[model samples]
Target: MSKFWSETVKRCVPYVPGEQLNDANIVKLNTNENPYPPSPKVVEAIKVEAERKLNLYPSPTVDQLRTDIAEYYGLSKDNIFVGNGSDEVLAFSFLAFFEAGKPIRFPAVSYSFYPVYCKLFNISYEEVKLNRDFTLPVEAFFQTDGGVIFPNPNAPTSIYLEIDAIKEIVENNPDQVVIIDEAYIDFASESAVSLINTYNNLLVIQTMSKSRSLAGLRIGFALGNSDLIEGLTRIKDSFNSYTLDRLAIAGAEAAIKDTNYYKSTTREIIHTREWITAEMKKRGFHILPSQANFIFVSHYNKQAEELYAALKDRNVLIRHFNKPGIDNYLRVTIGTNKNMELFLNKLDEILA
Candidate 1:
């Protein structure tokens, strides 16, 4: 709207994240954040780093954290690229690999941020519609004009694609880069990272925000061949050299080292998800077989909009997208057992 604004700025349509309410009493589950606190080791390491270096800048290369993450995934530091968050890494990938004239392919109902990024960067993209069951159509992504990127255990729908199908897509798109956003992979069955060594074009991106309980820390990384990592690094260096602070670096390192704690929390979330799915089905909700930490459902007798408003009024928040084809569905994060119980109680009251 401003006269001084450039064409790029004017054309941008920013992504809208979930509402963040600070009320302690509300059972918050709109965003897919970990319900448990981070590991004690992570907190302690962050505290130690905070006291040691308040004046100095964090390592520009972020070598140590990258090494730790690489070790965790059985990859070398050269194959990894750390960023402020997975969103930042994805942005870098968009600039590094995708071209403005060539078109990229992604799921139509996958991460909402893909379209936002494409629009921002002037990148032409093809939105391949998902199958009737909300599962990705593997064949549709083969031989893309530019490249491809999509969340593994896709967002909003919470449906996970098998690794075999992912391999097929990567094999077919041997010429172009295939970026797999694995933000929710910890809660899912398998990771596409296993295919990175076999396929040079595959880039697997992950985040500490979901399963590692570091949403506030904002740590995310990408795993790919050294060449693709170098490309991401070039984009990052052009944008901002010091994307991560000392606290985030230290916290992420500790989080990667403390695998047992995070795994325990992940198991709990999966258990809670199973229980919640059964409970919702008992209430006449048809839910997808979710492999992530959230569930997508639509009630047989209730409207999604009405349910969202009713839950909000009861201080139990969940997500309801007003977009076509999925307007009737709601995406609810799997919170703690207590939080889920409260949500179900509120739902029961509404149903009554």
Candidate 2:
């Protein structure tokens, strides 16, 4: 507690990222990162850019990457914006669109960063409780006058809502900004980007960190109407004109363009997730139907913290959040098939 800290700084509670342990032999599945390595094309692109452009700043607009994303998603460059990471993009969004005095609304069970962002920006917010089964309730959002945000296939719980349900919420509240954080949308059935043409207030945020296997490069983007993108751009330009380095821009563009590689990897991960879910259910664990690259499960007989400790002792790590309703569950990332088999075997041993 330094006396030099400003009042606003003292009040801020930063988001905690998942642990990245250095133990080489550990089966790391805590973070919801892609288990496969990034496409070889991404590495080649970075190498080419690194050789020639160490002295110059990256394109401030990130025009080429923006155009690539726009073309991929069938949107205009005016509707897309990029940032250092989805977290920064989210920060800019909270500052630019959700600072109104009205209380912002989101799911009680969602990405943990939402509360941190609200506190960091000093915006008043209320949690609209998820339904009895952890699904988002469309009616819970109808009474609110403020902005709305929630992750699709909502995190920690890994439950997904249909696109029609999301459109109902957005169309119902056309006046307020409704942000859909889709960091795991690639694994889901549908994306909110499809609704952007109809709902001007809809802002869909995504990141390369999850599906594209580029978390190390730190690239993320937002898709919305031109006006909303402009607002985010204003906040970003005022903060850092060159949030992405040259290598990042090059690598991300390459990754986005490598459609075959990205699709193949995601398919494999989804397959692994299904197998893992079936096996866990056989072991008497209640597993949520997940559309993301992770599964949320809890056993009726074993405590989550106790299982987490046992797994850690065996050098296999998974995420266990001690938050109120979800304290008994473990959120396990979909790892390679071999890794998952090892995890299940170790769990059987620990339980025995």
Provide the TM-score for each candidate, comma-separated.
0.99, 0.99
Best by TM-score: 1
Q: Candidate 2 on 130-213: residue-level lDDT in tens?
A: 887898988777646787999997998888889888888888777889999999999889999999998899999999998899
State in Å the error of residue 103, model 1. 0.6
Backbone clash pairs in model 1 (N, Cα, C under 3 Å; residues 3+ apart or in different chains), count: 0
**Which residue pairs show backbone clashes in model 1?**
none
Could you list the CA RMSD of all candidates, in the order they appear?
Answer: 0.6, 0.9
Off by over 4 Å in 2: none
**Model 1: residues with Cα > 4 Å off, grouped in runs:** none
Say which candidate scores most in lDDT: 1
Tell me how far candidate 1 lies from the true structure as C-alpha RMSD in angstroms: 0.6
User: Would you list the C-alpha lDDT of every candidate in the order shown?
Assistant: 0.94, 0.92
